[model samples]
Target: MNSTTINLPTPLELMIDLSDDQFFDLCHKNRDFQFERTASGILVIMSPTGGETSNRNIELSYQLQAWSRQNNLGKAFDSSGGFKLPNGAVREAWATPIRSPDASWIQSERWESLTQEQREKFLPLCPDFVVELRSASDCAERTGEANRLKTLQDKMKEYQENGAKLGWLIDPKTKQVEVYRSGQEVEILENPTLLSGESILPGFVLYLTVIW
Candidate 1:
């Protein structure tokens, strides 16, 4: 991960140095707030998702979980699961090695390859699949803010750069979805009723009615 500055409008940032253990402990201690870090070790405090967004997130997770169980192709993770990116500098210098996607899935083979200790810590690899939902605070219409949406778009690009096979940036307010695939242009779907997993997931298809 490269060190870059992101000028956030809210939930002020504080630059701090904490080891992985320290950071993990801090997260548990302050369970009420969401936190993220940059590759340069700047700690970001994320606001909680609103009720509507939270509900939609639950549905999204449920669908991914159901499909994962039936297919047994990979493991599904919720918003709480933090992962350590593989392409990064040493943790001592930059503690921004961890990130938590709203929803993610890792192929079974890659998951099985992790040591128990590594798995217990922040997962040391990018997931095969990732999803980013635009909450009320993130929606352009709701807040009249483009930064949040742009931030998410940048995140999707980061995921692709870091080796994620596929990603989805779902914007509920606009009923639009931006599909990200490795080495390809982003495909935007307007008011999509269903999203096909394509070659990445083969037969898996996500119905958007519940989300809408």
Candidate 2:
């Protein structure tokens, strides 16, 4: 993985950082670069290309948003927000050690409780739901899903512990979703006919046809 270390300055120093236009220009110059903010600092991310997998992930994100709106599930986002952990630590969407999931959800009340800085950072209190879309860039063939799954599973546990209700890991090639609950055993939905869950988004049913 490629990485770089950025020195974080004080809040006042942050004011002297790149202007908004400069930021956008920088981003435009680097297709691999992604920008996100958190309570701690701003983040710039670069990752290997995932080609078709990236497109499929994006499609799923739009579908999820439509489903959320249709079901009145508050709001949904695709790699677009940070997260405020229970410890008051804020994490940027792109700064997460792991790749950002395709989509995430948070209830209205939690959304409203954030501070302006937190809001600007757009950090979720705890996502009521999360979805990770598997990609060819994933080290599935070598490390397999064990390590990745464990990491995601741990994150799901953290979210659930912090009040999140559900999580999903979607593998496009297999057309499957692995559902994770805090205490319950993981459930695998192979070639699911429908994506339905009441805990996270009540009365929502996303058919498989859209995905496959």
Candidate 3:
């Protein structure tokens, strides 16, 4: 939470601008990569994760989805789901900074409030609970301004600023988790064996055995 940087992927940033529909078409055309445009209009590209990251990510996603199903408390999503944070800085259909956290959940009431058409597209608001699982590649050493760890950290802050109630930035490599919540400083847990969803997720708990 203090002044620190966690660098993420060395993204390929293109200066070109695309409309919402245009970006959607580009995303579909290059389905293998992740395309994101920052609010300032910088287009970034992230590649598909490696196998180990994929495996760990599924565990996170599966556990969250299963918990949401049992509790009937919210809708859970995998990394493929995109969210359009309500920054009010961009147009409606194609918003700036389309984010796809590794695992995310929206409270049931909020989930149900969206119209079917709205639900089918990038979610128009930040999630109540979100998780970003860091992989080895994401933390690989890079020179200059490329910092994968800082990238996700900034993302966590962005989620909080955009109205996320709680977020966990988990790093399997270090067995550490940075907990972010509204109106609170970041909490760092070292080699924690488990994580509680706390009030945001009610009784949901995530055991780190498989992930670690």
Question: What does the lDDT come to for candidate 3?
Answer: 0.84
The models' CA-based lDDT, in order, is: 0.83, 0.60, 0.84
Residues forming the 10-long window of minimal summed lDDT in candidate 3? 87-96
| Candidate 2 ranges with C-alpha deviation above 4 Å | 1-31, 34-49, 71-73, 87-99, 122-124, 139-145
Q: List the residue pairs that clash in candidate 1.
A: none
Model 3: CA > 4 A from native: 1-10, 88-95, 143-146
Off by over 4 Å in 1: 1-10, 88-95, 140-144
Error of 3 at 19 (Å): 1.8
Question: TM-scores, in order shown?
Answer: 0.87, 0.66, 0.88
Flag the better candidate by TM-score, 1 or 2: 1
lDDT of candidate 3 over 1-212, digit per residue (tens)? 68987656546777777876687678878988877776666787888888999999999998898898998988999998888777763334343777889999998899899999889877888999989998776777653324778888988988888789999999998899999998799999999989999999999999898999
Sorting all predicted structures by TM-score, with the top scorer first, yields 3, 1, 2
Q: In model 1, how many backbone clashes occur?
A: 0
Q: Count the backbone clashes (under 3 Å) in each candidate.
A: 0, 0, 9
Report the lDDT tens digits of candidate 2 across residue range 27-60: 4576554443322334434354456766666777
RMSD of each: 6.6, 8.3, 7.8
> Model 3: which residue pairs collide?
6-149, 6-150, 7-147, 7-148, 7-149, 7-150, 8-147, 8-148, 8-149
